[model samples]
Target chain A: MVRGMAFDTSRRQVVKGFACLGIGATLPLCCGGTWIQAVAAESFTLTEIVDGVHVFTGANELMNEANHGAICNLGIVIGDDAVAVIDSGGSIVEAGAFLAAIRGITDKPIRYLVNTHMHPDHIFGNAVFRDAGATLIGHRNLPRALAARGEFYLRSYRNQIGATLMKGVEIIAPTMLITDRQELDLGGRKIELRAWKPAHTDNDLTVFDPATQTLFAGDLVFLEHLPTLDGSLLGWLGQMDELAAIKAAHVVPGHGTAPASWPQALQPQRHYFEALARDLRKAIEDGTPLAEAVGTAASSARSDWQLFDEYNERNATAAYAELEWE
Target chain B: MKAVRQDRRPMAGTASKMAAALALAACICAMPSLAYSQAANAPSEKIWNELKTDVFEDRTIQSDTGLIRIEAPKRAQDAALVPVDIFIDPAKFPGGIKSLTLIVDVNPSPVAATFQFGENSGVTHLSTRLRVDDYSYLRAIAETANGELHMAQTYVKASGGCSAPAVKNQDEANRTMGQMKLRQFAEQDSQTGKGRELQLMIRHPNNSGLQKDPLTQYFIPPHFIHKLSVSQDDRPILSMEGGISISEDPNFRFDYTPDGNGEIRVEAVDTDGKVFRDQWPLEAAGL
Candidate 1:
């Protein structure tokens, strides 16, 4: 499901109203003056963590009009020769702001545009960079996954976010596929990209920057937001275990705030998915029907995450059916 | 007709006006189900009367809810392929089941399919997948040989059954349309006390006439399995007339008697008038 709002509806309403004021007050300022700088500053905010590495933190939230469709965490890695962008935001507007933010920091050409996965929140900004001559990069399964569900995702978003918000939302397939692992030299720094098994999704990839020691672990690590399951739960747990051993100083998650210890950032999600798998297996063993399993499985994790009501039951149903066959 | 508005109010005119009309009809078909919405958990007499009058044509129905058991996901993962299973025990019924009708209360063609079983059909068990078009109740009705219709229902949350895009290769789908394969499972039926459960799989695109071909950007004309029949030695035992709601690579399961030492024949005909027939013996097909 395409989520369009961040956490807490009351706060979102307030934020939406303030955003309206900010845009409205600047209408007159847009008459070819210092509006470009003012509009850029007010439209989106980016935090420069260290040199050549910047991140835009979308409210740990949903995808909607007020948020400018930036509901996921995206990052940029700049090297001496070129820059590699890790996941653009939900729409072209967000992508344009992201490109502007990159241009403000550096004049280097963007060489690599890596999508963590095919979720609309993370990968809908491909055309903006494609036209800018950035080669789209993704996991091996990304192109197929995009082809299979891309139109459905677009149609659903058009129905939900309105056509105006999705004026340039094109399902751009990745030209380069990272089969196992690929490394790119951004000037002196080298960024490592790995295509994963069917974990978070069939097309999940992680971008690891050794210079910064920051693992851009896309949807693989959800900090506070609930872990939405779209792929194999068993595979996801396996990936969590494998990723825990790799030492990284700090991590940038796809959706939430990541901490220094990247492995610790993954515990709650690992627990949630493990809980789902265990409960589903138990239900399957007991011959408890799908509806009943959906009603009861993983209820304990409901309070720990946002949008648990929307996604967990479906997660349980999918997990139950998969485990039932096995 | 209730009311035709200027530019057809709720939905936009993005799709072809004709396509939009069909889709609107699909949405409007969901209204009667909403009347049963608030009291959804309880089976209403009015709902049954409407179904009988419209689909069953004033046929008297008996309330034997527990006699029929339907299995389906409460919220389907894919709107186009919602798997369902219906089971009816002869011991529970006064007489054996003769006909079964599967209905999605919100689909454009709400009567998704109807299956008429012969006396040789053994136990009344059927399993298949359907396109659910919208969030509405799915009814699996079993009519006993004595002409008593019993119903089992589950509320499914899904949509786009009649119009979901076909993501498979169209050329490949066309090349392999109407191919049918039968797999027999070793499960005994209570009614015949001598047969096993049989499953038949048909490969067809079942284009809804609503989906656009990705390459051409033109609406793919509706081509689906218009008729499917199963027989023992050419004696028709069970048959189904499907529409756009039937999924591609459609799968179905039923009960059959294997005591006749005769071959089980399957015939599937597509909307394009192409007919495919396959048969298998109690043991194997090649032998």
Candidate 2:
């Protein structure tokens, strides 16, 4: 009861402070000053990957209040008449900050908002883009994924990032779903969106700008970060070659360093995935139980990735659950 | 929390301790969220105290008898796939164990399952995965042939923040529902002498249906395996009456003394009255 009361008190302060920040809005005498510092802290820089493609490389960390839930990469592809943004971000505050950054660069109408997948980190900010009148685009499976997990995401992330940062976050499903492939032309710049077959997730969608040959490989291409498996492990391993064959000069991965050279950037993750699969297969063949096998399942790749300790065992557990059926 | 952990009687034998250590280390590696760390400090026994009366009906359950031992991660790695192990000492139960009831105190469906063992069935070890919705006590209550109830319990910190106890691939689960797979291994139990181990996996969504469709605002209809039984040579080994607390693709692994080289058989029925049955020739011991 005490804990609940404490949480509610803090949440009320946040709401009160938020209302005071809007222009011409009444500043209540009870409003706390924490919201002022929080709002002022909302800013992130976007790196121009090419002439028309800009990538806002998020910090290589998990979603947290400190990071303001901006842990996954967000992209901005500009054109003469319109713009297409890749991934909304992890929280409403981060998305609001991202919108402000885009407005600084161009006044062009934000035409298309693309979601890479249904992970909370990538789609929590969907409301910001939807409110901006951008037509949301995602893989055909996105709606179902969101329907199944959207409420869970909201409840869970509120606990992770706190109510202050999650102020206006909402799970806005995409209206324009791509079943196979779709092309969006922002004036003369041509952007190709291809939905993959359940690689990193069931609804993974990649945004490729042919003009600059830059590929926005959502969570499908994790570099420094260990790849978390929520979909089929076999499906992801089987599609590695096809993903590498995408003709792109550079790639903006969902996490870690941005604009990495094509194909080569995937080698490290490929080795990690293969190594994990081999270990899990051996464990299964030896009749090792999931609880015992997962401890050392992917220990061989422990030195190769960031957050390996945090995500490896979970990946092993999920992978073991999948492979044991085979 | 400390008092409750300290209250647990020390598990006898090196094998049980080793198994407990391994399970703990694996669970520690799987704790991804820092949110649960704070929860460990605020232990709640209120739910368990209130739940016991409705479950056991005023029957006294002995906790210090050392007849049963239950093992689960202090913090679940995945809410949907929390592995749990229960070991019953054959030496303590001269009449053999009769039934085992598993309860996850905080889950929407608190009573996860109840398993009834066949007469003379040398079943001493059982392991299965469960879905823990929140920080709760996972207890295993065992009833011996003499009608004595002995219990062991462990607190599991759920991965509540991001991971819901929901199916990962709903489409894949639906497509493969009712499929069954079995694996066999040889075991030499110090107490039961020689025995055979069997791992049975059944494909089922085991949906709790507690979740509302955020779009439609309607509860997803609950569907899950409600009944399952396993036997060897026409002799019952174990059977369960389960609930949605079981993970998707329900799985069970256990050690039982093989009477003969008869075929091992399994039959499972879901809430929809769909029956799935399969059998495999019992592999020789020490394979």
Best by lDDT: 2
Docking quality of model 2: it rates as acceptable
* Per-residue lDDT of model 1, residues A1-326, tens digit only: 11221122232211121123344343222211223211222456556554556777766666766665687888888888999999877877677677766776678999999999888888777777886789999988777656545655666566545566676777887889998999988877888999888767767899987766778899888877777666667778877778887667678887777433666888888889878888888885654545566778989888888868666766675566445434
Predicted complex 1: CAPRI docking category: incorrect
Tens digit of lDDT per residue, candidate 1, span B1-287? Answer: 01111121222233244344554554455457544433423343455557667877777655545888888877675465577888887678755777888887655456777888777566567777776655667788888777778888887765321123332333335665665566666654456563476667766767554433332443335566666788888677788864557665677767665556787777766655556777777654210
Mark the regions of model 1 whose C-alpha exceeds 4 Å error after superposition.
Answer: A1-43, B1-287
Query: lDDT by residue for model 2 over A1-326, one digit each (tens)?
Result: 01121111122211111222343332121112223123524347776656766678787787888887888999988888899999998876667667777776789999999999988889887877887879999999888877767666776676677877777677788999999888998987779999988777788999988777789999999989888887778888889899999988888999989878888999988899889999999998878889999899879899999989778887888889999887
The lDDT per prediction is 0.66, 0.77
Q: Looking at model 1 chain A, which ten-residue stretch has the lowest summed lDDT?
A: A9-18
Clashes of 2: 0
